[model samples]
Target: MTWLVTGGAGYIGAHVVRALLDEGLEPVVIDDLSSGHRGFVPEGVPFVTASILDGGAVEAAIRDHSVTGVIHLAGFKYAGVSVQRPLHTYQQNVTGMATLLAAMADTGVEQIVFSSSAAVFGAVDVDLVTEDVAKNPTSPYGESKLIGEWLLRDQAVATGLRHTSLRYFNVVGSGSSEVYDTSPHNLFPLVFDALLEGRAPRINGTDYPTPDGTCVRDYIHVADLAAAHVAAARRLEAGQPLEPAYNLGSGDGVSVRQIMDAVARVTGIGFEPELSERRPGDPPRIVASGELAARDLDWAMRHSLDDMVRSAWDARRASTP
Candidate 1:
């Protein structure tokens, strides 16, 4: 079956596209290239350079490719920045999602897999977040993701749209040296950039109540995340039941210091990370249980912490030249 991968030129989207191909499924890409790279989409995959908000363009891609389903990943995804640009965030995420759904509905497309976020459950106190956790989004980005899920839920009820939203925790690592995380706001890229420039990576909030006096978060590999999307799509195609949402996360949490240690070990860098005060609204710990996803979507943390750091570092280094 052919799938439409929105934001397919981006790091995670690109990985999803490749994963689709690996499973003998066709994938058509539609990306605005706002924060995505054209080179990331593999050759021979049909590419549409348009925003998801452009209903005409989105409809055309859906119809032209005979897309059986959509993996919606296009959006303004910066949570902290979304706080300052709430309107832009809503425009891209909320409105863009509505537009995409409208186009899909108009075209009789019946299935979709949304790329949701753990941001929907901001600053939780839980040891392991499940899908039923209270959603109190802290920023427009998170709010928008929650709204997108609502859109899907409402549409599913109204039109029998088969769908599921995957709530990602902390996505890291590379499936291939060809595709790597490029977000300036993400942790892996920031740390790698600091080390490459011979500067110490800064660790915000070493006074947190966690074991290492730092924040703890669930980290999952990009490849594993991609596989989950495929599983969801296949399940939908097979007319199997699925939860409205699933947290793509590590059951156990990893501290900031542990990530730093992994980076140093992988890169052979010995510099200590600079400790600083916690950023406002930053949660000390937020890990999630992927039990539901594991049961339904074959979700698993296939890469170790060091593997994540090494693969990401290697991919970033490969792009340096």
Candidate 2:
């Protein structure tokens, strides 16, 4: 089966594309290169350089490639920046999703796997977040993701579309040395950048109500995450029933201090992290249980904390110079 991966040139999307190819499925990519690297896309894979907002390009890609399904991952994904640029966020994420869905409907392509985010469940009071948690997004980025999921649900009802959204938290590590997380706002890249520059990495809000006095988050390996996407696609192609959404979490929380420790241990860079005041709206903890995803999508924490840090660091270092 042929699947079109939106933003396939991006870090996570590239990994997903590789996973699809490994599963013996043809993959086509459409990315605007806004935050994606052209080199990240493997050669010989059909690539269309266009935004999902462009209906003509999107429709043509679907028709020309004979795309059987889609893995939607293109959007403005910075939650903090979305607060300052809400309109831009909505335009890129919400409007882009609508356009993609309309293109799918026009082409009679029914199946889609949306790349949703844990940001949908903002500041959860529960220890382990499930699929049914209250979605109180604190930023336009998170709000846009939730609306994207809604678009899939509404399209399913109206056009008999088969779709599922995979909500994940803090994707880290690299499945291959060629692809690495490049987000400026993500913690992994931030810490790595600081270390490379011979500066101390800053840990924000170390006074949170957690065991380590730092915010705790669930981190999942990108390779494991990519595998789940392939599993979801296979199930959908087989006409198997799937939940509306599934959380790809590790079921274990890692504190910022712990991550710093791992980086020091893996990279052999021994330096104290500069602790700073808590950023506004910083939550104490946000971890989820992947029991549902494990049962259905064969999701599991295949990589440990050090393994995640080491792989990401190695990939990042290899990409430098």
Candidate 3:
């Protein structure tokens, strides 16, 4: 039984496809190429250029591929800008998720692993965020993710669907040099772009309550995160019990200053980040405990902050003209 990986040509999705292949599972891909590159789809994989919003197209891909499961990842993921494009965000993430689920139901593909985000929590006033935290999403992007989770839950109750949502903070690092994070809004790419352009990377806030006065957050490597997804899929395939959601996090998160320091050390480019005023509603820290994921899904901080920086730098350099 094969797995259908929606958005499989994107950075995290591409890495997820590799992880599934490494586990001896066949993965078929469907991507709209809006934010994903067609070149990122591996040569041997079956590729369908379509959006999850197109439910008929999604269902056709699943039926054509004889898919038994799915890993849903395609969405408009910019939390900050989502406020300005709330309808678009809902259309892509909320309506798109419903379309995907409807297609899965039609195809009888009940097993799924969703690429959820810590965005669902927004800026929570807590030391360590958990699965049971009162969700108070502040942006359209966050709200869409939370609503997607709710849809999954409702589907599970109504149709006995086997599903799990993986909530992650900041996903970085590449499993292969061929695949890299290309999100224009992400930190690694922004910093890499600045460095490659011969400019210093900038930090948003430097007077928070955390050590070094920089915001702290969990930053998991993409490969490790992908492995957890595969593990969840395996559990579902084996008819074993799985949690509704798991946070793949570094319990004690590294600060932005620490990331800047690591990047400089790893890339051998010595320069301090320029500090600016904190963005509105930016939290001082938003770390989470991955103990549950560690126990069930083989989740761990396998890469250090420096390792993450080095790998990301290598990929960015490799992709440069």
Candidate 4:
């Protein structure tokens, strides 16, 4: 059986493609190259350069590859940018998801492992968010992801399609290859860039109620996230009952100061960070309890915060021109 991986050339999607290959499954990729790089697609996998919003192109790719399942990872993901451009976020995340689902229905593809986000949980007061947490998105990006989950659930109920939505927290670390790096909007990559350039990193918002007076987030290794995606796809293929949603994250939360310290420890960079005012709609703390995913999908994180930072530092070093 072949799998269609949307955005397979992207940072996280490329790692998923590598995992799929490791499982001895063929993966066909579709990406528009807007934010994804063509060089990241592994050799011998059929890759189509097209947007998911184009129904005809998506349908053609599905039919050509005999795709039985889809790992949907293509969407807008910048939280702060989404607040500035709500319409674009909704169009790419919500409307584009509808277009892909319609294509899947047309082609009789019944399984999908969607890449959702923990931002869907919004500003929850709980220490650890679970699958049953009430979803109240705080930004256009988060709202778009919540709507994507609703679309998946509605399609499953109405069409007998089996799906799994992995609501991930902060995705960090580098893949085995140095070709893939962090997203430009992410905190770690920005810090990495500053350190590489002999510049000071900037820390935004230090008045939050967290232990370090900084925002706290659960950072999951990219490889671990990819493993969960493969597991979800395998379970769905086996006709297992669909889970409502799975939270993919480490159970522990790391603050911004902690991350900065890790970077300094790993890279020997002692540059002080520039303090800045908080960005709008920034959550004080967001941590995930992966017990549900651990029980249902047997997913567990193997990398530590030190490991994540070290691996990222190594990749950043290798990527330097």
Query: lDDT values of the candidates?
Result: 0.94, 0.94, 0.92, 0.89
Q: Global lDDT for candidate 1? A: 0.94
Residue 180 accuracy (lDDT) in model 2: 96
Per-residue alpha-carbon lDDT of candidate 3 for residues 56-90, written as tens digits (9 for 90 to 100): 99989998989999999899999988999999999
Our model 3 lands, by Cα RMSD against the true structure, at 0.8
Which segments of candidate 2 are over 4 A away from where they belong? none
lDDT of 4 by residue, 243-305 (tens): 878998688789999999998998887878888999776789888999989987878988888
Q: Which pairs in model 2 have colliding backbones?
A: none
On the 0 to 100 scale, the lDDT of residue 280 in model 1 is 88
Q: In model 1, which regions exceed 4 Å deviation?
A: none
Model 1: per-residue Cα lDDT over 1-321, one tens digit each: 899999999999999999999999999999999999999999999999999989999999999999989999999999999989999999999999999999999999999999999999988888899999999998899999999999999999999999999998889999989999999999999999999999999999998888889999989999999999999989988999999999988999799999999999999989899988889888889999999999999999999999999999999999998
Q: In candidate 4, what residue range of length 10 has the lowest lDDT sum?
A: 173-182
Residue 183 Cα positional deviation in candidate 2, in Å, after optimal superposition: 1.1
Steric clashes per prediction: 0, 0, 0, 0
